[model samples]
Target: NLKIILGHMGEGLPYSMWRIDNRNAWVKTEPNYPAKKRIADYFHSNFWLTTSGNFRTQTLVDAMLEIGSDRILFSADWPFENVDHAAEWFDTASISENDRIKIGRTNAARLFKLEA
Candidate 1:
């Protein structure tokens, strides 16, 4: 199956992941949507998310905790946003340096199989 990449660091999906997991079952009776796994499972296995313009540290941290650092991608949200701002926030975000590197560049490079 093709990988599904999510932008805006999941566009608040990390928060919703649990909510869906909790509520998906409740909604199952209302809607006919069927899934064999928890919502977070799909998040962990099928999706990759980008920081893009949503550069909030707490949300980044929450996403990392909820999904994983390996799935997080970085972007400047160019045209609509400023690269310098993205850079500054990323540089100062409370997460570890390794996590920063992984999200900022390595993850996307690996996801796209880019050559150094």
Candidate 2:
């Protein structure tokens, strides 16, 4: 469990979660095949996505909408960007207070199982 948190998620696949859920990719190879749930289904509440370099508000909203408020995280990627900018953007983003709490703190705490 700790390894998953410290491990690297690989390159260029940050958005890979969305591609797997495309309608065209899920056709059954044979008849009577069961329809699979969207990638968002696998985005469990215990997992929180990093803000990383993605500072777009619409995309953030999409992620929140798809994965639920409880699975979003606030990140700055350190030297790549300033912490204040991330904090400000998230602080003023057009979303509900409940969602903000989820993305800004609750999600990270839950994902890392941090005690506070």
Candidate 3:
């Protein structure tokens, strides 16, 4: 029903995923799922991420973004960053509008796939 492109994964919240997944102590109680599952199950080829906010290069954020923009959306991180900041980096981000559409909201419509 939906899709996106993953670029610069490990660009966000992925390393943390490893931490959560590897937590033997936590796994003992919540054996059904891992802290990262809420985020990782979303992974798909169509899922995409832009290098926009690689500023922090948070593996968790990047990995999560790679999992899908549905979880990660493009933000200029304004005040702390800028619109052009995201735009400039995104220009060469190496993903497509099929994925871009999601970041731009076209994919949102399809997810919500609204008629309006």
Candidate 4:
């Protein structure tokens, strides 16, 4: 399966994952709904998110809680946002060092299959 990466924390989709899944469950009787699985399931299975221009720690933490650090990558939305600003914020974000390393480096490396 092709993996999809979304920038700006899936444009805020993480915040709505629970609602989407819950409503999706409620709508199980609808035959017209083409998706075979819940939205959150698709998120978990096939999606990755990037920090991009949205750099709030709370938002980042919320996304981490929703999808885990393994599915996140760091980005600056360069030209639109300052790379240094992104770096500074990310460097100080209130997450474990392991998670910080994953989001900042290893996650992208693994996702893109980069050579070490």
Candidate 5:
């Protein structure tokens, strides 16, 4: 399987996801998308989102609820964005400890197959 990581929560891909899914669900005409499942479904299965420099609690909560935490990775833009800021925000995000840990480190390790 090709590991795909999406930067900046796919740079508003989630909004497009909602639009695609909504359109596909409501419209009955022969759709242009040939996928077997909805766009959001594909996203859930194939894509990973990184927080990077976009660190907003509401956005994080929204994404976590919309897609999930397993595919969300913690990242710092560095030079441009401070690692300390990211860490600080992450440490206090509204998500649970388990989800926080998953997004913060475990998920990345699992995705990259890092041991220890």
Candidate 6:
């Protein structure tokens, strides 16, 4: 399975997934459309998201609840956004310590198969 990682909190897909899926179910796609499963199915199976420029806590928590921590990775937008701000926000985020560790470090290591 090809794995794709999206930055900027999935470019807002986490919040829009339900709507996308709902519309997909309500409307018929063109015959040329190839996807047979729900958008959330693809997200759960093949996608990962990064906490890049987006730093809102409620948004992060919403994403975590929608997609689970295993599919998230921490990222600093670097030259585009201050690393300190990202670090400060993430360090003080209200998520549980277990989830914080997973999102901040372990998830990437596990996805990349790197030695810890």
lDDT of each: 0.85, 0.61, 0.51, 0.91, 0.85, 0.90
Residue 5 accuracy (lDDT) in model 2: 22
lDDT of 3 at 95: 58
Pairs of colliding residues, candidate 6: none
Indicate the TM-score of model 2: 0.66
Model 3 scores worst on lDDT over the 10 consecutive residues at 55-64
Best by lDDT: 4
Model 1 residue 69 CA deviation (Å) reads 0.4
Model 5 alpha-carbon miss at residue 22, Å: 1.5
In model 3, which regions exceed 4 Å deviation?
1-12, 25-66, 107-115
For each candidate in turn, the TM-score is 0.86, 0.66, 0.49, 0.91, 0.86, 0.91
Q: Candidate 2: misplaced stretches above 4 Å?
A: 1-19, 22-40, 44-47
Q: Per-residue alpha-carbon lDDT of model 3 for 1-116, expressed as tens digits?
A: 36654444434445455554456546556566544434445544334554444534344235444465554455554655677866766555555656555655654455545847
Badly placed stretches (over 4 Å) of model 6 are 28-31
Compared with the true structure, what per-residue lDDT tens digits does model 2 show for residues 1-116?
21222111212233566675565357765435464544435444224566666677887776666556665677776778788887888899889998888777886776667957
**Predictions: Cα RMSD each:** 2.0, 5.2, 6.8, 1.5, 1.8, 1.5
User: Model 4: per-residue lDDT, tens digit, 5-104?
Assistant: 9999889788888997787677647758587877788888899999999999999999999999999999999999999999999999999999999999
Give stretches of model 1 more than 4 Å off: 26-31
How does residue 82 of candidate 1 score in lDDT?
94
- lDDT for each residue of candidate 5 in 46-102, tens digit (9 for 90 to 100): 888899888998888877877788989999889789999989998998889999999
lDDT of 3 at 36: 48
